[model samples]
Target: MIDVTMTRAYEMMVILYALSIVLYFIDYFYKQAKIRRTAFWIVSIVWVMQTVFFLLYIMEMKRFPVLTLIEGVYFYAWLLITISIILHCIARVDLPVFFINILGFIFVTIHLFAPDQVQNPLGESAVSEMLIIHISFAILSYATFTLTFVFSVLYLILYKILKKKKFSKLWSRLPSLQQISMWINSSILIGNPLFFISILLGLEWAFMTLEGLSVIDAKIIGSFIIFVIYLIILVLHRKGKLSGLNYSWANIYTFLLVVINFFLGSKLSNFHLWY
Candidate 1:
């Protein structure tokens, strides 16, 4: 049976994340510094709760519990929150943290409410270490892409606001379009290499464990398509064919496709789905 105490703590964490998001938006639009500070503190508290839950979960499982889809999503959400906190302190940026926590909230909420299948914990030998490395890099790459997508979105929003001459407090908070573009480009540069390495490792694992690499697998094809899309973006950026709003729009479209592939296409995949 599920541990009721841990389950309650998890639900509370979700609530805190949601509350923090609401506070952030309120502060953004209202220009309330106090509310923004409160939101940041709320985020800190939420992180602490998440840490407690993590410790409790590890104690209960006697191993890291990220071998399955739900657990993996939860772990990723926690990871993003941790990174967001650190980045926020160093950069004093709020919008990215707001968007990240929103995504984290969604991820954890899904993990909490969705029907979870119980499976025995696997020993370290059950899954090869190489596969874990591949999956870790894949998850990190996805997280990096998410940040890039967020900055691109900020570029678009700020551009529209500037064009319309509707200035708000949030306007001042956003980085310039040039800065946002640079961040997007850098994120893609970092994420693409990591994802490329992940694919290589995955292929290595397949060659070693399976009859042969499954090039036709739905997940592999979907991942390859996303990779190609990003590669195109990188090429366009390098050749000076895309920049500013054009690049931002392309990122938005690519990110939308990525979201669909991750959330929907996985359901159709033979190997990627958790069930």
Candidate 2:
């Protein structure tokens, strides 16, 4: 079964991710077009392998691999690739190969090298499918935020280039300012509805099970703060009240909040972290 295979698949992905990172870094500073292509090929092949691994995990476990630190790292790598693909699609931003690979590499490195922790498959068959929906969106929101953080960092680099009038490297590689702003908007649009619905379902599920008690724990607080911040950003963006600089700042802030929620907040606040 692929669930059993996931372990092997993860190991392979780590190797590939590391190799890709090395190649990408070499390509980035050396200005070798062929090296960049080779790096992307390595990344792409591993992503496909991991994609299959992910699908198999869901099938065997009947749950998204968002639980446990290791699985979370795996999913984070997938999220980075997904975001990179999306950004690549709409903006055609030629972000340094290693810039994207770094996040993926970190995830795999942690998964492979860090101490083992038990994974919590919270989607036990007993839970209602509705509850599953809540859990699904929770992961999706977190993943989206992960993507935003990476992109925001790239945006800052591009902005600096624009400021310095050094358009050679950054201008050629990154997306236009308008495209990055739109990317921010699109990430929010995808994440916002999912966040809203997930919370509602979470509350409903808890109410049905725990007599309407929603624990005001770290997990909930983290998610709530993230949602509120994004909501405000959405409003500001819509109203044209947020400058590109401010938008980038908000993206970074929200991403930091997401990370905290994933690690610290979830540990302190919610039962959600177990999964």
Candidate 3:
């Protein structure tokens, strides 16, 4: 009976989180301060509920919730939401907050619907702190990159609107294309170093624990590819070769590559599997 009740609670949490995502989107498009405020509170409430849920799981399992792939994703999403809330409060970037919640919602909803991986408490226990650090930084990098992608796309849309001279409430609410481009650039600048560190940590952990990792492994190769793309974009920007629409377009392409690398590479990588 308790299990069933907690299951229902979990579903309720998901529903509330999903609603918060919708409210955030509405706030973004409608340009309502009240709607944004409401969305923030909803996100805060759901974040608290998620924290409690994880605490309960920790008590029940007698370990951290990172023992399973689904639990890891949930925890990662929680971190992303927590960071988004902090940024929303400090920076007041509603569009980025909205898109960040969209990613969080998709991750948790997918975890709910997907088949569960077997709990490998023994293996999970054996995982080193270095490995955990690597994963945490990698997830953070992805979150930043997701923000970069959204801002770049927004820059493009706003550019189009300005070019067409289409004035609307949304247009008035949006930052200029130059400002959005700066956000994109900042995200990339931050994410690149973090992701680079994550790669180094991952390699170190692999060598220490698994003897070594294959260079050809899908995740490794894909990560390196992403790193190279990020480096290339930075170089181009420095050389004044990519800017404005070209800069945004490069980000769009990079984001697409990341999506494919995540979904496709994960499936094919033995080293990246949970169990």
Top candidate on TM-score is: 1
Per-residue CA lDDT of model 3 for 24-135, tens digit only, reads 7887677777877887898899899889987997787665566456877887788778878987987677766777788788877876777755466447545777877777
| TM-score of each predicted structure versus truth | 0.88, 0.83, 0.87
Ranked by TM-score, top first: 1, 3, 2
Best by lDDT: 3
* Candidate 1 Cα outliers beyond 4 Å, as residue runs: 118-126, 273-275
Misplaced by over 4 Å in model 3 are 25-32, 58-68, 121-126, 211-213
> Regarding TM-score, does 2 or 3 come out ahead?
3
Worst 10 residues of 3 by lDDT: 117-126
RMSD for each model, in Å, please? 2.6, 3.2, 2.6
Tell me which residue pairs clash in candidate 3: none
Candidate 1 per-residue C-alpha lDDT over 1-275 given as tens digits, one digit per residue, 9 for 90 to 100 = 46787788777878888888999889878878899888888889988998887787778766666667777787788878886788678767778878888888888788888776446434345467787777778888888888888999889888999999997765788777787888899889999889889888887876776564457876677778889999999998999998888899898898887777777766876555254
Clashing pairs in model 2?
A: 217-269, 218-269
Q: Per-residue lDDT of 87-110 in model 2, one digit per residue for the tens?
A: 545554556335666776777677
Of the two candidates 1 and 2, the one with more favorable lDDT, higher being better, is 1
lDDT of 2 at 88: 42
